[model samples]
Structure formats: structure tokens, C-alpha cells
Target: MRIDLTSVFVDDQAKALDFYTDVLGFEKKNDVPVGDARWLTVVSPEAPEGPELLLEPSGHPAVGPYKEALVADGIPAAAFSVDDVHAEYERLRAHGVRFTQPPIDAGSVTTAVLDDTCGNLIQIMRVA
Candidate 1:
């Protein structure tokens, strides 16, 4: 089966959508309601109509524990494969994004870590 969807635990759905779609250059794939929260998803412009990143609702009873666990353990941000780690990192940094770790070479790939400001460390990777 083809991998088409993934979820990112977010504190606020609308804000997350704005950041991911407006800031990170992603396009909205879904914006329908699914019970209490809406089914919002975003896709990379480079991979339009490809895999989607779901902005999952946090503060929910079931996912609250997991989200808290990840945040407490300092392992929250989700990663995304990038075409150019340095360029993307620079562009994001220019947009006032805080990066805990700068771009560094990791043999086969170059990687960088940025703070999503939403209780996570988002990693961007690119093949070297």
C-alpha cells in the first residue's frame, strides 16, 4: 500500500494549518469536519497531490497522554524529507523560525533541527 497520510499532534488546528500551509509552503489537502475536530491535511508543494501530513488535534483525552509523553521526553516534532536541507533551513530561519540545531552533515544525508514552537523539534533532511 502507498503511504499517503501522517499526523502531527498540534495544540491548535487552525494555527497549525496556517503555519504549515502559509509558512512552510504546504497546500491544504483536507478541511472537512470529523466530529469535534476537522480533518485537516497538508501536502508539500514539491510533492503536490502526494502524501499528506495530518494536523491532528491535541488536548483530546486519548491523544493527550501520548502528546504529553512525547513533549516531556523532548521528542515531539515530526520530520520531513527535504530537497535541500541548507536552503530550506535558511528560508525557514529567515521566517523567524527557531532552530535548536543547525544544519550538519550526517554522511549519507544532511540534517537540521528546528523548533516548530508547538512543542516539537522538526527535523529536515536531505541526501548528500
Candidate 2:
């Protein structure tokens, strides 16, 4: 068995696209309209054919509370692997991204958490 796709609930698809692509460096893979929302997904540039991250609409009632609770508890909505967690964190900070947690060495890995601005916290990590 293999993973094909996963999703992160987003308040706005357009803003999510910009942040995921322009800021986080993911590439848009698919964008098909579906009713009031679109089937928007992105893939890492390094792995165009790999698993896709779906930017799902957060119109559902449960989403708001779920996201709020996660943020309140400092939980990341998604985690992305990077070659260098510190470098990625610095680059993101320069772009005005607000981080909830700075890069910290955590035994086998290093990680930092940043707010996605569209109502989610995302983690960038590197395995040692």
C-alpha cells in the first residue's frame, strides 16, 4: 500500500496556493473546479509525481474549531521535510512568515513551526 494524497484544511484556496507555492516552494499539481470549491492540490517540486497535498476548503463547521484547537495547543497542521531546517526557517522568516517555534535540535531531527496564515500551523523539519 502507498499514500497518494493528503490534505490540509485551508480557509482560502487562493491564499493557500500562494503560500504553498511561493513561500513553501511547492508546485501546483491540479486545480479542478468542484461546486463552490476546487480540487486544488500541490506537490513538491523535487517530486512531481509523488504524493500530493490537497488544499481542501474549510467551510465545514468542524474545521474552524479543530484548527483553532490545534493552534491553541501549538500543534502543527502539517509537516514538510526539508534538507536543512535552520536554513528553511531563516528563509521563511525573511519572507515575513511568523513562526510559533524556532528551529530546535530534537535528537534525531530538527524542526520549526510557522503559521500558514490561512488558519494552520505548519512544521518544517530535517532528519539527522
Candidate 3:
């Protein structure tokens, strides 16, 4: 068994694309129109054929409250692996991205949390 795709609910697909691609460094994979929302997805530039991250719309009834609760509790909706958490965090902060939590060492791993601007908190991490 293997994972092919996963999703993060987003309030705005356009903004999500910009952040995920321009800021977070993911590459756009697929973008097909599906009614009011497009079937948007992104893949890591290092792994173009790997699992895709779907930017799903938050139009569903339960999505808003679920996202709100997650944010209220300071939880990240998704996590991306980086070679250096501190470097990535600094680079992102230089780009005007807002981080909810600064990079902190956690045993063999280090992580930082940032607001995705599309109504979700995302974590960037690295492992030692």
C-alpha cells in the first residue's frame, strides 16, 4: 500500500497556490477545473512523481469549524520535511510569512509552525 495524495483545506485556492509554490517551494502538478473549485494539487520539486498535496476548498459545512478548531489549538494542518528547519524558517520569515511557532528542537527533530494564509497552519521540520 502507498499514499498517492493528501489534502489540506484552503479558503482560497489562488492564494494557496502562490504560497505553496512561490514560498513553500512546491511545484504545481495538476489544475483541472471542477465546478466552483479547481482540482488543484502540488508536488515537491525534489519528488515530482511523489505524493501530491491537494489544495481542497473549504466550502463544505464542517471544514470551517474544523480548521478554526485546529488553528485555535495551535495545530499544523500539514508538515513538510526540510533539510534544515532553522534555515527554512529564516528564509520564509524573510519573505513576510507569519509563523505561529519558532523552530524548536524536539529530540531528534526540529520544527516550526507557520500560517499558510489560506486558513491553515503548516509545519516545516527536519530530523537529525
RMSD of each: 1.8, 0.6, 0.5
1-128: candidate 2 lDDT, tens digit per residue? 99999999999999999999999999999999999999999999999999999999999999999999999999999999999999998899999999999999989999999999899999998988
Backbone collision count in every prediction? 0, 0, 0
TM-score of each: 0.87, 0.98, 0.98
Model 2 segments more than 4 A misplaced: none
Ranking by lDDT: 3, 2, 1
Question: lDDT (CA) for every model shown?
Answer: 0.82, 0.96, 0.97
Per-residue lDDT over 1-128 for candidate 3, one digit per residue giving the tens place of the 0 to 100 score: 99999999999999999999999989999999999899999999999999999999999999999999999999999999999999998999999999999999989999999999999999999988
The TM-score of candidate 1 is 0.87
Q: What is residue 13's positional error in candidate 2, in angstroms? A: 0.4
Residue 108's lDDT in candidate 2? 99
lDDT of 3 at 42: 99
